[model samples]
Target: MTTTKRFFRNKRDGKWLGVCAGLADYTGIDVVWWRLGAVLTTIFALGPILPVAYIATGVIADRKPAELYRDNFNPEEERFAMQTRRAPLRSLKDVHGRFRALDRRLSEVERGVTTQNSGLAREIDSL
Candidate 1:
């Protein structure tokens, strides 16, 4: 199953407007890397454009949900997040496999339920 991940500004860890923090959250990169990259972009004649983009992103991105801050990170979720950062397509295939397994298990449950209902119907008819 493909689930959507919302991009939210990480207010708790942010230094300035949380643009770098948001990018780190989305890309699974260390926040320092993003900050360094922003500085490099500014130095490399990207100039005011980089700062403008950061400001625009800060304005555009939504703040992270309160519940997410409260909830503890599950190991599976963390692993999946890391894997997605490394290889998104590979992780998608892994998700497909998991969904297929779930589908098979659901079909088995439906079959069992149908069988039990039919047996009960026959018992009622005989009685």
Candidate 2:
């Protein structure tokens, strides 16, 4: 027996409630196609049923984890997360190096400020 991943609303790709986007992610189909199909179905025979179903599903489904963090979705952050997941230690090391460099720069700025002449003197000199 195989287990399927539970479907969640893909708030990142979705324009509204992300029902079609969620369906697309779950079924491995393009979101545009799902949206087109939904609209056509809603306009043709299904009438209001499809839209109601969509709304209900959107309300009931959980938001995808990627979209849960911020007010708006960011695909770039998701891509970064995936890359970091692939090489967590390397990513951590890179981040640490960047923070260390920033720390060094800040320390230099602090030292310069502490040892430098007064702001009034510098202003007078610049004139």
Candidate 3:
């Protein structure tokens, strides 16, 4: 994946802006690695880098719009861009809010299936 996202929250099934998974998705690195790295960086550096990087990424990274998936992207650049970029909302719990928003749409699909079956039964009864 040559095309990288400077900063985008990922649409991951795993959670949060899907930052970790997205990071994993982009770099082909496991999300575990990204999490570990982030924690280690914070622990060792102690104060400045993590906070500063987060602030910078908030400004620099790109948002994940539909446009990104228009073509087959490598996601490698996007991976580094995220790791280098900023906070990207690093937890699955936090990103769950975005995924939660899709609940209505998903329910619509689920409901449609039952409704369709009911309609078929009604049509049969009418016959």
Using lDDT as the measure, which candidate wins?
1
Q: Please report the candidate that would top TM-score against the real structure.
A: 1
- TM-score, ranked from best to worst: 1, 2, 3
* lDDT of candidate 1 over 19-53, digit per residue (tens): 88877777777789999999998999799999998
Cα deviation of 74, candidate 1, in Å: 6.8
Ranking by lDDT: 1, 2, 3
lDDT by residue (tens digit), candidate 3, 1-127: 2345444655532344456555664555667887778778888866678756755654465546665553654565555444443445463444576478788779998898757587788999999
What is the C-alpha local distance difference test score of each model? Answer: 0.80, 0.76, 0.59
RMSD of each: 8.0, 10.1, 14.0
Residue range with the least summed lDDT across 10 consecutive positions in model 1: 1-10
Residue 51 of model 2 has an lDDT of: 87
**How close is every model to the real structure, measured as TM-score?**
0.58, 0.49, 0.37
lDDT of 2 by residue, 1-127 (tens): 1112568888877999988987766665667999999999999989999989999999998988853445554766655454464466887898899899999999999988888578878899999
